[model samples]
Target chain A: MSGASTSTAVIDPYAPFSQGKTIQLSSASPFLPRYLASTLPPHTSPSHVYNTRLRGKLLILDNPLRESRSAQLKQERAAKREAEKQRRVQGVMGRREAKRLGVWELRKEDAKWALFLPIHHLWLGYIAELLQLPPPPSDDILHSTDPSKHRLPSVPGTQAKLVKADLHGSILSVKRAKNADLVGRGGIVVHETENTFKVVTAKDELKVLPKRNSVFTLRVPVYAVRPGTGEEDGGPMWEFELYGNQVCFRSSERASRKFKFKETIEL
Target chain B: MFIDLNVPFPEPIVYESQFTPSKKKQKQKPAGLTNAHASTSAMAVVPAHPLERLRVPDRKALRERVEMLIHLGYTIIAFTQSVQSKLDPAAPVNWFDGGEGTVFRDLDPRFNGGKRGVVQLRRLNVVLDEASEKGFGFNAQTTQLLAGYDILSLTPLTTSTFQSACLQHSLPSSSTIHLITAPLLPSPRLPYYMKHTLVRTALKNGARFEICYAGVFGDGARNWWANAREVVRAAAGGRRDGHEGVIFSGGAGRVEHLRAPGDVMNLGTTLGLPHETCHAAISRIPKSLIIRAETRRTYRAILSEPKLVFSAVPAGAAEDGGEQREDGKGVKGLMEILNEEEERSRKRVLEADDAGEGQEGDGEESEPSGRKRRKRRRKNR
Candidate 1:
């Protein structure tokens, strides 16, 4: 509470009404509208400044404070934030594990990889906004006959997709691997570690694929419908092969890593 | 699409006489610098000095020439380096280090997000003489040495070299050589007769003949005219087979010699090449040649279009996202038919259940009949 509002708590013995009158009629109270005493005929509203009826009863109005208003608001905003923080789901790591998804079977009571569809949908929305991917071509634009208007955005080239773009939530399959068993197993990348990717495969089994002499085929939607739409999809996915040898850093580290063009023969 | 595939990287110092160097160390330093970068990059093995080995090209002059070519709207430009004899796989040097980012650092014009930047290519032109006839180093061991270059061409001075260039060294996937260029400057005539069989075979194998416009602007203009005209007639003028294997390039040794792409196409007219054909010579013909050369990275030299196979779409109700519409209108029509069939089959099944209500409910008999109906539906689909 400000000093002005707090002053109301103390009672003046001689003139209780004068104390209230001072709060509304002092120089600081110019923020409120002023009434003309000369225009009043008799005694409808009480006399504000003179207090002609009761003499020898003087009161002082409190001063207006600039800092206290903002201070009070700051305290309320922080309290609101603390309340919001309490609602976040807690996990083994910490509170933010609210973002972490449970096993696919536990999610929908089905062991099928399809159970993690909601998480996948959330990931698509996350990646689409993160990459600033352009909106999908509308039905009208797709059916348009004019070739000149067919403008596919040129930003999502192979270099941008492979070099440093985050691959945490993208769908990836092993195109080739040193261990022949990992030749074709692919799924949504649930957890990305330093040198291995913890993938949730279509069979709903988690596969820890090492980043050795392995080549991963990544399919990014050319135009993906943002999540929450009636039918969310990766409308037209463009396939790119990422040599595992090139990307071996952790997900956070890869964001700042620089990749140079190596000799084609070496691959 | 406009490309000058033969911009020669000239030596910095060209002595008054063809022969002597001031000292051998000057030549050796550049060669070592080249090999260090080349071994890492995919470029052919460049020998210490080739036929034009007397002078090292001017770096400033080459940079200025390429800048001028980019301003002239040449989106793709290959810095041409010629070798005297066959490359030794044992001690290979890569002289193409300066054509790309390192030398042309900050060279890109900062508009359109640099998407229209020049595609700097490294081309090795082997000036095939009698010594190279012994061996052009087209062996399996030379893949590393030869793979360094993007476009490989042969300047055949003899009939035997010409025949080998067309027949043997034309595998774009395995072997590096695809372009066949001859010295069409100041010669009394071509060193060998232009055989029809040799020209057709070379064209069929995707080998293009280049006529350097830089040669025409010099003192050899007269000889260039006759030679260029003969090459064009031999390559594209004969029958209506759509054989346009001849390409025009700027073999500019100095900055002043380079010309714009449109002006070069116009000059090709003086050599009896039609306007449209000459336009393709600089644009579409070389574009396909350079793109096909990427097949060198593929196994068994197989180059084909790739099709996208979407991960399987599972049971419809269980899917999160909508299923893919595989081509546009045709798939929609197929989907409509499937929807109508499902409705009709569902109505028939309901009617069958109603009719069986009066009869004794035999679970086994009904199950077989239902399985048979589903089987027939699958066959119809």
Candidate 2:
């Protein structure tokens, strides 16, 4: 009687059974066993079995469960609030980093560089500072001395030397040029490159003069230190008249170049 | 010395327009306008004055005109030749040999006698109506003009044209720019063109505003008068602000149109220019312009303040060497005086220290206070 009851309970009522054929079919149908295993609760305790069965019914869509619209909106709002909180944390971190790095002070220095240097030179000077190299000459060097005392050297030998000297902060006057309009104009040298000088004239106007086909007389001041006292003594300034085409390179580049000391060539 | 900075020379060739109608339109027979027609015809029939006649004078006539100008005491006369454009090849070719050489040649023989007056050949480029289509190109035209002319005067028709001509040039600082004020007579007020900022820039760039007096003697006298008054007001305003760049000229096209320097000065005074400024316009300014033109012609000349430094003279030459030595001495004397003054001050300070010490020692010493102290100090020294 017990055997008969066990067989009846183990067998599916809806499935067809035919002795040997049914056994073969049951062995071949592995998916049915896998599905039955998935549906069965692992635990036999009353509370666990009840919960597992409820989850199985929900997974199978036997119960048509839906979330409320207000609850969905509240979830979306919470996600946005979390994202905003993360952004605020990031902003606070950024401000703290900027403050620690003295970014505002750096910006103030950049502003001063923008006022004085050309765009390319500004970057060069900035990079130079980063590399801990010597900074390029500044306007303060020019303003420290009396400009009126600065005169150009008239001697030919001295003139050649003066032409090779760094022209930054020198007072320049156009002596002669093919352009008649440029004759006899004077200006202060603000910047210089390989082929041009950026000058600020007496009228407070900036002018760029090409170093080709123009003659310039540079008035450079000479400052000396007293040998004994080591005090600065204002020396007599010298004047130099130069053919612009001959000295059309940066002072540093020209210094590295080798030239015949006494080559008798007409400029 | 009086100078007429602008007198149009190589008299203008009048070409009658081929497009004029073959016959005048018959007076419209206005049905009831007979009275108005009669008055209009009467106005047109009035006899033309001798000065009003516009005739192209020959070279002889120009010489006679110069003689008349000399008689009227114009010590310096800048004969202005109008240059049209480079596309007009004739104008540039005419400038090369015909303009400067011919005028000077024509006037030289007549003025060879005791008169030490000068005749300057100047160029006037009237850039009217065409500046809008093509910007004032610093091309072959400008280069040729700058190369050929002694003094270049640009008469831009509009304010923008003026700015482009004056401010946009590469070398505005050294350029001798003259602003012609005659054309403004039939148009707007002078201040419309001569804005304060523009005037300041012009002054800074060494540009001089010129007033041509011959415009006043033209057929449009009323318009000219109004223009002249406005120009004077603008110039006077500039002067009051301590920037004086006004120059007077008689841009006479013919002998009859010419006015005396005295008359121009009186006109300047009447137009509200200060007396000294009126004199400077004719004398000092023109002289400086002549020097500038002379320097422009000679490429080798080096202009030093108050004098020109010539490179042609040998460094060791004794002819003008004394002047340089004298200048050196003068500078050295000034320096010596300064040094002496400094030494004297130092000596005074040392004497003050000695006096202070002597006064302190007097209380402790047993010698006569003042008289013996000097002898004692001398002995101690």
Where does candidate 2 clash, by residue pair? A151-A238, A152-A238, A152-A239, A153-A238, A153-A239, A153-A240
What is the DockQ for all candidates, taken in turn?
0.02, 0.01
Which candidate comes out best when scored by lDDT? 1
lDDT of 1 by residue, B329-377 (tens): 2212211222233446567989988887757467667888899998896
TM-score of each: 0.45, 0.41
TM-score of chain A of each: 0.51, 0.36
Overall local distance difference test of candidate 1: 0.62
Locate the minimum summed-lDDT window of 10 residues in model 2 chain B.
B299-308
lDDT of 1 by residue, A94-209 (tens): 43454464332234334346655566666667666655667767766544545455454453243453456666556667655657567567676777778887666776767778
Q: Model 1 shows how many backbone clashes?
A: 11
Off by over 4 Å in 1: A1-267, B12-57, B98-103, B108-116, B301-381
The weakest ten consecutive residues by lDDT in model 1 chain B span B314-323
